[model samples]
Target: MAALEGRGLRKQFGGVVALNGIDLDIDTDQVVGIVGPNGSGKTTLFNVVTGVHPATAGTVSWQGQDITNIGAHRIARKRLVRTFQQAMSFPGLTVDENVRIAWEQGRRGGSRWASPAMILDFVGLAPLGRAIAGSLPFGSLRRLGLAVALGVSPELLLLDEPGAGLN
Candidate 1:
């Protein structure tokens, strides 16, 4: 059985069809990429699967159980995590603090006060750990985003346009 499967998934935005009967099967420990031109429904598909948006039609199965309309936090508890195309950060927080927040929220195995130094080192942000996230360059912010997602310890990681703004 596949780790995740979508059967005839459909989503509509008013009169426009965002996803039309899309089907996909992903197995454990596999690397799959979804590529297409703009407005091809990639983000919509992720949103539906991750519970950001309810599907207009079809079913989603994860580990043989139906999860089509599960809430986002519920899905995350089930080990499915996703990252946005645009890097998101708490502008007022330090880089290390931002990562720490994610670590705590994602419920990774660690103390709430785990060494910020260690976490920064693990994500290659040691040098910038003390810097304010809002003041960092775009590339560094992107890395920060990845580090935050990694903190979630996801079974399934969905990255949307991870390289979108890279120079």
Candidate 2:
């Protein structure tokens, strides 16, 4: 069974057809890429798959289960994770704290006090663990976003533009 699949997925914004009858299927441990021009529905497709936006038509399935209109957080809890085009980080939190929070949320029922050091080490941020996330360089921030997404150990990892803005 496919880990993620979409059939006849469609979305529109005031007559601007973002996606039109798109079909996609992804199995486990697959590396897939969707490339297109600026407005070629790339982000729209991710939005639909990640449940960030409701599809105007068609169905979305994960692990053979229908999730056409599921909520984003719920999807994340189910281990279908995605990162945004822009890097997202909690400015007020330390790098270690951010990773720790993600690690805790990923396990769903795990304790927060367990093995934060391990997560920091896994993301290669052990040295900067105490550093404030907002104070990091752009590249580091991007890596931090990846680290957070990895916390869930997702079956489907959607990276919008892992390398969008960098100097």
Off by over 4 Å in 2: 109-119, 165-167
**For residues 1-167, what per-residue lDDT tens digits would candidate 2 score against the true structure?**
68899999999898899999999989878998899899888998999888899999999999988988888888878788999887789989999888878877767754323576776676577899999999998878887888888776677789888777544
Candidates' C-alpha lDDT: 0.83, 0.84
Off by over 4 Å in 1: 106-123
Tally clashing residue pairs in candidate 1: 0
What overall lDDT, based on C-alpha atoms, would model 1 receive against the true structure? 0.83
Q: Return the top candidate by TM-score.
A: 2
> TM-score for every candidate vs. truth?
0.87, 0.89
Per-model root-mean-square deviation over C-alphas: 2.7, 2.6
Error of 2 at 159 (Å): 1.1
Model 1 Cα shift for residue 3 (angstroms): 1.0
Q: Candidate 1 lDDT, tens digit per residue, 94-114?
A: 998898777776565533335
